[model samples]
Target: MTLLIETRELAVAAADSIVQPTSIRVRAGVPFTILGETGSGKTLLAQAIAGTLPDGLVARGEILIAGRPVQDLAVHERRALWGREIAILPQEPWLALDPTARSIDQVAEVYEVVRRRPADGARDDAVEAMRSLRLEGAGRKLPSELSGGMAQRVALAASRAGGARIMLADEPTKGLDAALRDGAIDLLREAMGSEGGLLTITHDISVPRRLGGEVAIMLAGRIIEQGPVEDVLQRPRHDYTRRLVAADPANWIRRIVPERFGDPVIEARGLAKFRGGRLLFSGLSLTIARGEIVGVVGPSGSGKSSLGDLVLGLIRPDAGSVRRDPRIAPLRFQKLYQDPPAAFAPQLTIRRALADLVARHRLDATRISDLMRRLRLSDGLLDRPPGAISGGELQRFALLRVLLLKPAFLFADEPTSRLDLITQQEMIELIVESAREEGCAVLLVSHDRDLIDKTADRVLALEGSWMDRDAVA
Candidate 1:
């Protein structure tokens, strides 16, 4: 197999250096993954290869695509060669997608740009790409109209449409449910047949294993260990790698056992929701009690997030009622949305947003600092706008904004989905501790079966608007 992408002593620096000098090679037909915690510079490395580094970031060292040096190429020159030789699926789909245009149009644009096809041909290719990704009706919807997971699929569709020999996917499955994730992995594997290869940067430990390829464990800004997936994941050589592997929910020693139930804090009865005149869910009902965690699990587009919105009164139910305790203030029921980037004010810096929240709530600086520490967010991030930070960091910051409120009832929609294994555990622990110590009732919506099994006192499964109680063993 021919080497597709080679990085020799590649380093990316911003206001201050982030990724240290790192060397790696990706070969055709092989899948290579770089796994790391949030802010480990995995995305930076991938962006360096794609020549898409942000404005302030500078790349040093050498990058070669198909044995041709690209580090010296002009931006437009690199972009001109991108689709034919390389393609990048960014971690945040919103960044890659045009918010005003329909999803299908954006995907069609990729076909036109990369393949230089006619308009009708591009549209046909776009539809085919989306269909392959199980995004049947997504083409007509604008980026804002699609869910986080759906937008992610659209990005994948665009990347696939480009027909690049080498694909660079950054957290491609960031917001997908288990079923969708499996399908995505299959698509990625199929894309990396004998003709091409894939280099993915993700915190998802499961991805590298599923792709059946080499895995590199990145810590801080460097790859500390690299080898075959099974060897690296099963018998990690570095302490950081071991810690990361152990942090997987499968390896965790502690579990959250449901304690005795308390009085109901929030209740939903005969809830029904519709989007674009299509029924999302109907006749769904659940109750969350004080100091209880109720988990909702289902496939993508199954209305799990809509249920959270209903409980939090973010959206009105069409045919049902959400009853909140009179004692609970409006702010006492908060929601941590799945799409963290969309949840914040794009114009506001993280520092400004947090400061406003703190001022309004009269929260103490020390308390906020401690919570940020627990969430593994750096002080430097506070200065950056929500768009500037990675999705995981934004997710943590979103949670922090709500945690400061000390809400009596919390609706967390895939709260930890964007996070890496270690941070997922930390976030889970934090949520559980909040329920135990602060008597905060939580509606935990996620597709992670292990997480639901471990943290939820009761589980509810959603299928086409129908809700069924899941027996917890």
Candidate 2:
């Protein structure tokens, strides 16, 4: 066995101080995992190893590849190593792909660039990889045209097509359903078996156990525990590891009585959306009673977001109608999008943003200030642009924006998808509390089974546009 990558006393910085400082080594034919809560700098560490850290952020450490220090390598040279010698699968699949280009062609370009082959041959390779991943018809579809899981599969295929000996993946299962997550894990394990060393950064504890390899649990930028998979998972030494395992909402939610305990605040019947020549859903019927937190779950492209839109009237349904109580006015049906920062104007100050919404909805200005306080946002964050705040903070602000409306029905689409574990937990708690406190009905959409189990009063499984009648009945 040989060390494919070695980082000695590696320290990463964002603005002025350190974020994640640690040392690790990647040995051939082994899977090395960086496990931690979100914002633990797992992505930063991967960037440091891949030599893709952005400017203004400094890295101090020795990054040795094949027994040679390559910290001083130029950007192009470092990037060249990717897809040829090394590769990375990022957490944000959509952002990773070229939204404007065909998914298959984008992947083909990777192989063509790496192998210096003709475009036709590279495309053939891309199509072959797609077939191997059980993705049919993906080769001709644009990145935006593919479903979430399909897009992710395409991204993975592109990363591996160039025979990259070392692979790094960040949160590969973040937004996928159980079935897709299993398929992705299988793909990764097989890729590692064929290519050698693999480094994956994930907050999901089940991932390490599934990979069955050497795992390093990180906390606050340091590896607190590292060992074989079974030994570590069976008897975790660190409190952080224990907390993560215990916090598996999927495990606890099954046994407790759901908190459906308040009033019918909102109703949707036969809601359906047709976009890009595909029917998302039709004749979908559901209701969120007062003080109820209902969760929608399914595989990628299951119409979760479309359902949210229908409930909020953000988009007109092609078929079924959505009717709400007279009290649930247009302004009262608030939405907190998955990407909160992108949902708002980047140039607008947070205060101005809230004020504009309040004025538009004829809300009292005092409600905005009180809502921010209730949402645990600092006064200092109010004047800052959406870009200045963290994803978690931005999401909190989005929630505050909704809270100000005192909405009767709330539509939250993958609201915690981009947040870290602690922040995700906090945000979920806040939402649940707010829904109960205000007697609001919440329609929560997420791929996280654990989240669904914990927060939902009732679960509605969406398979494309069709509801799982067996389960729902």
Candidate 3:
């Protein structure tokens, strides 16, 4: 196989050294993977390679594409190269796409802009991309119309259709179910293998293993381990790599999620939701008691987000009624989303945002401040705009704001999907503490099995149109 890209002693520094000088090579007809915990510079390294690193990020290293140095290329020049030779599937599907355009139009634009094609073949390719991803009824649908999984699939199709020789995918299976995740990995492996080269960046250990490729584990901005998938996963030499594998989200079921709080915190009977032409779920009966976390696990397109939306009243159920303590059900749930940056106004400081909420609700200010600190944030951070904070920090702030409402029921939808291992731990601990303090019932929706096993007392698996609820033993 020919070497497609090479990075020699690549070093990137931002707020300190995010990616210590590292070197790796990508050969055609293979999936070269970068694995690491969140905030460990995996994403940064991908950004550096793609030439889309955030401003103020200082990078030092040699990135060679086809034996040519690419660091000196202009932004537009890089774009031209990226569109035809490299493609990136960002971690956040919604953020990666435009909210206003139809899904088909967005995809068509990708082809037009990247392929520089005004030909009828572009539309044919776009539709084929959607079909390949199994995105039915998605061509004309807006990003908002599709479920989380559907939108993510559409994004993948767009990237694949770009026909780039190299692909960089970040957390590509984060919100997908086991089946869908496997399928996506297979699709990526086939595409890369058939045409030649692709590099995937993810915290998910399972991905590289299934794809059977060279794996490199990054930690504190360095490539700590690199080898074949079996060698690294089964006989990991690095301590950090071992830790990352041990904490794989798929293993969450081995640990026990304690039911320390007593009593039913939230109750619902025969809950059903119907919208457009789909039935999310019907006759869904369940109860969540205080000190108990129930995880709703399912594949994409199986209504995981829809279930959360029903409980939160973000979308009203057509048939079933939802009853929750008035004090706990906030119109806008804060803890469930990782990028609170996306929800906030760029001009509003964090302090003003929280203060405005407190003022509107006639709540005490001191309590809100204390909550923020407990979440590992500083009093000074409150003065900065949400955009100024990292994704993890924004998530913490968002969770704290929800806690400020002191809701009796917490509905978390894929709360850890975008978080690194450490942040995932912190957030889980915070959730347990808040549940214990308020005797609240927490409903968590996630694709990470390890997260479910460690944080939930019960598990519900949704497949196709069925939900099987099981008690955690």
Candidate 4:
């Protein structure tokens, strides 16, 4: 089989080297994955291949597509080639999508640009592609109206519609639930069969295993090991790969000692929520006693986030009521939103944002510094705006902001979904420990069953306004 894409000692650098000299190949009709932890330069390599590296980043070595040297091509030539032969599924779909345009139109535009098809024909193809990824009727909706998972599918639909020969997907399933993730994997597999080759970069180890591809383990910008998926992941040769495999959530043991709970700090009774004239949920009831950690688990778009908003009084319930202890002040209730970047002002520096929160809460500088240290954040990070930092860093900062308030009740909604396994474990441990120390009742809304099992004292299975007790740990 002919090689679809090949990198020969390809290196990328910005001020300092980001990706070390690396060589890799993707054959036609095959899938390959690059696995690495956060800030390990996997994304840089992907960007280098796509010729989309940000300004100030320099590329060295050679990148070939269908036996053509991309480096030798003019800017316009490279752009034309990219439109026809390559498509990128970005790490953050929302960033890639235009908020003003309808999703379907955005996807159809790709087909029109790359395939030069008629508008009507491109529209039909775009809709068909969306349907293949289970995104029916999502075409008319603007990106702002779609959920994180829905937006991801839209991005995938656009990539598929582009009819590119090689696909580069970066953290394709970062925010999706298990079912959606599986659907995405299937779509990518289908694309591989049609598109000739697929290269995926992700921190999620399960992705490579599920895609059944060649795996390349990246550490500190270097590809330290490469082989079949099972051999590389299961029987890794490098210490870094072995550590990553071991750091899988499945290997982590829960050591949370059960503590007795007091009276309810926050309670929701027969709660109901509606969106877009559809009932998201109704007749849901739950309680978070003081010092208790209650885990809420459900499928995507099943109102887990809605329930969190209801508890936090961010959204009014259509029915029933949410009550918090009268003694607990309103400021004592904090929410850690799922999209950390959206929670802050984009133009404001992290230091300015944290300072405002600190001043509002009358918190001391010492306490803020201590919290930053605990979260493994550096002092320099405070100088950058929210958009300038990584998702994981932004998430940690968001958590730090909420924790500074020393809330009596904390609502954490998929707080660590963007973090790597090791960081996820660390954040979970810190949340549990801090919440316990402060006697703060927590409502942890997540789709990760292992995470819930490890952190929650009790679990509630949510199914469209109904809550069933899954277990009491």
> In model 3, which runs have C-alpha deviations exceeding 4 angstroms?
14-16, 116-120, 249-263, 326-335, 348-393, 404-406, 466-473
Tens-digit lDDT track of model 1 for 1-473: 79988999999997677999999999888899999998889998998999998888999999999899999999899988777788888888887888899988888998998799999999888877887777766667888877778889999988888898899999999878887898998899898898797999999988998998898999889999998999999998899898888887766554556658678998889998987566778887888899998899887777888888888878899999989999878888899988787789999999999888888878775677899999988898999998788888899988888888898999999999888899999999899888888999999988788778878888998874321121100
Give candidate 1's error at residue 24 in angstroms.
0.4
Q: Distance from true position, residue 88, model 2, in Å?
A: 1.9
Q: What residue pairs are clashing in model 3?
A: 29-196, 249-450, 251-450, 252-450, 252-453, 328-407, 328-408
Off by over 4 Å in 4: 72-74, 255-259, 464-473
Candidate 2 TM-score, C-alpha based: 0.86
The sequence of per-residue lDDT tens digits that candidate 4 reaches over residues 1-473 is 88988999999997788799999999887789998876678888998888888777888999999888897677788778665688889887878899899988899998887889999898888877877766654677888777677788888888777777788999998877777788898788887794488999988887898999698988779999998998887787788777777777678777565657777998889998876555777888898988889898876656788888899898899999999999989998989988787799999999999888777768876777888888878897899888766787899999888887888899998897777777777788778876678788999987687778877898987664321211100
Q: How many residue pairs clash in each candidate?
A: 1, 3, 7, 1
For model 1, what is the error of residue 69's alpha carbon versus the real structure, in angstroms, after optimal superposition? 0.6
Off by over 4 Å in 1: 253-256, 465-473
The all-Cα superposition gives candidate 4 an RMSD in Å to the true structure of 4.5
Which residues of candidate 2, in runs, are more than 4 Å off? 137-141, 253-263, 344-397, 420-422, 465-473
- Which lDDT value does model 4 have at 111? 85
Model 3: how far residue 234 lies from native, Å: 1.8
Tell me the tens digit of each residue's lDDT in model 3 across 300-359. Answer: 767777777676667777776777655544542333653355677779999899889898
**Candidate structures ordered by lDDT, highest first:** 1, 4, 2, 3
lDDT of 2 by residue, 1-473 (tens): 78888999888876544455578888887788888765466777888888877666678889988677888888888877877778888766666888788777787888798878698888778877777765665566787666566677778887788787788888777666777787788888898784478899887776787888789887767788888888777899988887776766555545354544555766778777875556667778887887788889987766777788777777788988877777656677788876665588989999899879877878888776666665566797788887655455677788877777787888888787656565577678778877777787889988887788877878988776332211100
Q: Would you list the rank order by TM-score, best first?
A: 1, 4, 3, 2
